[model samples]
Target: MIDETPVLDDHLHLDPDHHRGIDAVRDFARLGGTHLLVVNKPSWHLGVEAESGEDFREVFERTIDIVDEASSELEGRAWPVLGVHPGLVSRLVDDRDFAPEEARDLMQAGIDVAAEYVAAGEALALKSGRPHYEVDDAVWDASNAVMRRAFEHGADLECAVQLHAEASEDMTAVATWAEEAGMPAHKVVKHYASGRLEGPTPSVMCDKERLETAVERGELFLMETDYIDDPDRPGAVLGPKTVPRRVRWLLENGHDEAVRNAHVETPKRVYGIDTEATLDRTE
Candidate 1:
């Protein structure tokens, strides 16, 4: 493991659908001696696709509640970053078994309901033993619209987004939308896999180079690690120890130290605490 302490472990997923409660999270962070940015995604399962009477509103409401709980409990220890996965959006918009017109209409209607639900303290979607929709087009538009409204609420929260684009062109398009919306395109991390069930390599497409580019372009970029591995795909999975190793590599390779320093620094600024300082004490 890299002996140096990290200011922040920039990306983490704490979906209740996958895991339960904050205790596991608290124990994980304490044992590792690292602070995390707990990320949450709307749960959309493949099995729920053909089901009738399924609604997306509950997903958003439930997700928000989990976030609220995590934020309240973790407080300065962890920050909650909310985002809609691109794959989910694509699934929502795609014309599946549901009638195109009805799917679209219901999707729009769900958004209105979600807004009200959010106002009513239903921002979380942690209904135990319940299933969710798979990724699609209606989910895409709805998630985008949901994020836009989230910004309007000025909740003083900054969440990370992960995009699962297939190609450079698709990635660029996603980047464009993030840029236009004033969302952190750089901070919006991408997960690499052959499809969605694989893992990524360290040298996959535009990994470190992309971070360098995002930094140069004044966008936010943070290394992230997710589950599963894909030989054809690449993940910035440097891990806790590997993070400082890469930092040393960047510094030795003639990259600007000031720029490298900003990777963790900026996240600290947005998350409202000096994780770097905490890391310093550990060192």
Candidate 2:
């Protein structure tokens, strides 16, 4: 029987402490059983100088530089889907605690500083909220610009975005906005608020109809639950092996092929190259 296991991973974070250099990434890639399309979103805190500033572009670039140096040493074994994840938008602007006018001025200044934040190579820090968080229009605009750059770069990369739905109405709006914002034919993963498939907290459960609609429109959608059961947080896991279980369920239910087509095939067509082969060029 052909191995039915998914050959690709849409998301993964390498251990920074261990993989301090390219040599480590090279070794990790050579032993790879699954092809990883890693999304890099870096951050620092407010009132704190990050050694680097607190934007995503800088962090992601730094991480990519490491990967590139390693790839040169080892050859291609991994690929990246670069973007400034939405979750950090608030944090990026929080330091300024900007007045509405100042916020507007900063946004008008061109999103390069925001891009610098990503290139700095810091991990995003998130705080738990009650139900949902409203994305400020300014931050959204800046993030979209960064995403556009990543899309246009057309390198050994794909676009990756994630969403969590807590309120039905809000989720509907999110779904609509996502559809409008060129969500079609991009790789996207969904994570529940509590981080599990079943029994998700109110903040995480999304309206199924809306989600299905997004998928039908050609947005690659995969459910990821590993973060739900994060060991760092006591009492996080509500289900056993939630990520694998959700993946298995989605596959058995026929969502896998549909997502694969959008995430993998369509990207190949757009970029005029097979990502797998490109990843094989990893050095």
Candidate 3:
């Protein structure tokens, strides 16, 4: 074991087709990871050849099964993070068969399903945001509307919302929308954030410099690998061990308390996860 403060990867994708299932979780835990927030990989990202909402739903359900199985294998060490990914929203809008209004409605429906799952205690957070890069104004507006709907539903259910957007995007605007939708700012987490960002919502960063800077600034944030687990791109973005490794880096550099806050305390506060309980179970 890592023999230090417990580590948590706040965001990770763990579909059966790509990820190694229980083996991956075992490896992560061995490396000192206490918990992880497992997100569903959208059909588009997995090259699933999906063309309609039904096709997407099939992929979404499969992903949920993967997450559920992982959680069972890990014995409560993993929590679910489910929602319509913004890229999937863009793809639906771009499909010629779907009218703009229909696409928006479909996206909102996906969020509704995720919210229901969260309310049923099957999930801990909702993942929604705009495209990684800029998009047409109309497409952007529709995606934002879908995200707002997720925020509103998450607020009602008291679940956190994890934002997957471009690092350069205006985080303040996201926080504003969350507030207007009645979700508190602290409940919105900007996924894949960097040092350049500053706003109401806390963020999770992967870049070493950005992670260190945010920690120095005393920013409320978490760490993630965003591990796709794709065999073709093995360890793409970062590996599953990235967060635990980073925790070790921080400890070696004399940032032990920062590591505890980011990997233990912050996640507990935001996602209602109990790292100590997870550790106790694993032990």
Candidate 4:
């Protein structure tokens, strides 16, 4: 099984303080997972107020620390993806008493800091998009502004940008925006994507039915668990080892090509990192 194609989770969040981080990753490795793109959890979850951009540094560093921690003691590799979540705009305005414009400025500043990490090659991607839920016009515009900053940064770094926008709506314009920002549509990922609302390269969830649909459609799609890593909820979105387990399902059920494309080729195309090469050759 180790000689088989590497199983990569495109968006897996690990909150060590609350969710037994390394232990959870060990679960993934035990089940044949080889790589994880460890994403930054929202700041509020870490009890961060984030009054300024620098306040986000702690979360970004901790995200990097998670990758470093896993790499030190485990064979499975991981990369940090840092950015200010777009929901921060609504939080700043409603919960924190910040004006819409002020919230926009703050979130933009936060992305600037995350971009520095990407530029330094400490992180592989930036996570940004408007809130998944509905918002008023002012908040929506501000959130779009923040998302644009993320696309702009991703363009400059030539890295991926994982979006967390509304899943029910079409994202045609979103892909156009990525192209407009000079970032390829494939590099602008749709994180936690349903069968619908996907960009050119959809990072589909690790589910049997949805995956079958994605495969039948015959497009280059990636898979992820979207594991929230919350102790209380445990596997709210999906379990820690869902991707590898699903890959096994695909292989045992005669979907070998799907496994290769989703697990190996698609990621190589989007991020330019060869999972198989890294796991097999490089030290």
TM-score, per-candidate, Cα-based: 0.48, 0.47, 0.89, 0.95
User: Worst 10-residue stretch by lDDT in candidate 1?
Assistant: 123-132
Local distance difference test, each candidate = 0.40, 0.36, 0.75, 0.85
Model 4 clash tally? 0
Residue 187 error for model 4, in Å?
A: 0.5
The TM-score, computed over Cα atoms with residue i paired to residue i, of candidate 1 is 0.48
lDDT of 2 by residue, 96-185 (tens): 465443433332232334333334432111111111366656655554444333323212223233432243422333333434544432
> Whole-model lDDT, candidate 4?
0.85
Error of 1 at 219 (Å): 7.4
Highest TM-score: give the candidate number: 4
**Superior by lDDT: candidate 1 or candidate 2:** 1
Consecutive 10-residue window with the lowest summed lDDT within model 2:
122-131
User: Which is the better candidate, 2 or 4, if ranked by TM-score?
Assistant: 4
Off by over 4 Å in 1: 1-5, 15-33, 45-76, 89-96, 100-162, 167-173, 178-220, 228-263, 268-274, 277-283
Q: How close is candidate 2 to the true structure, as a TM-score?
A: 0.47
lDDT of 4 by residue, 183-265 (tens): 99889888887644456578899888889988887778889998988877864899877888898888888888888888789
lDDT of candidate 1 at residue 27, scale 0 to 100: 42
Model 3 Cα lDDT, one tens digit per residue, 76-162: 367778888888766776665666567777778778777777888877888888787878877778888888998898789888999
Please state the error at residue 207 of candidate 4 in Å: 1.3
